[model samples]
Target: MILRSQRPLKLKAAFICDISLETFVSIIKTAYSYFTLLLYIAN
Candidate 1:
């Protein structure tokens, strides 16, 4: 019974990790693009 209850909690934690990772990737991409844009304007 305890094992079954803990299984769902593990799945929830994995799901949250996936979401945060995706968000982090998108933020990095946005920042990189902005950085390039700034360099282009400066040139």
Candidate 2:
């Protein structure tokens, strides 16, 4: 009975984790691009 109640919470957690992972990747990509652009300008 306890496991049944927790099932939805587990799914919600997994969904949130997936979203955070995607956001993290996108942030890193944006930062990387900005860094490269700065380097090019410095040259």
Candidate 3:
């Protein structure tokens, strides 16, 4: 939920970093999943 909400910021960050969309998307997905997993574990 939070991750979905962060998409705009994430895309901005990715652009600022000059990362290709394909690569940036993969990275974002990986990080988002990691964060959600962490949250699940915490709860």
Candidate 1 residue-wise lDDT, 1-43, digit = tens: 9888665332234455533455666778999999999999999
> Could you tell me how far off, in angstroms, the CA of residue 5 lies in candidate 2 after the best superposition?
18
Number of clashing residue pairs in every model? 0, 0, 0
lDDT of each: 0.68, 0.69, 0.75
Which candidate ranks first by lDDT, i.e. highest?
3
For candidate 3, the lDDT comes to 0.75
- Model 1 lDDT, full chain set: 0.68
TM-score order of candidates, best first? 2, 1, 3
TM-score of 1: 0.56
Q: Which stretches of candidate 2 lie over 4 Å from their true place?
A: 1-19
Report residue 40 deviation for candidate 1 (angstroms).
Answer: 0.3
Query: In candidate 3, residue 33 scores what lDDT?
Result: 100
lDDT by residue (tens digit), candidate 2, 1-43: 9888665332234455534455666778999999999999999
**Global CA lDDT computed for model 2:** 0.69
What ordering of candidates by lDDT runs from best to worst? 3, 2, 1
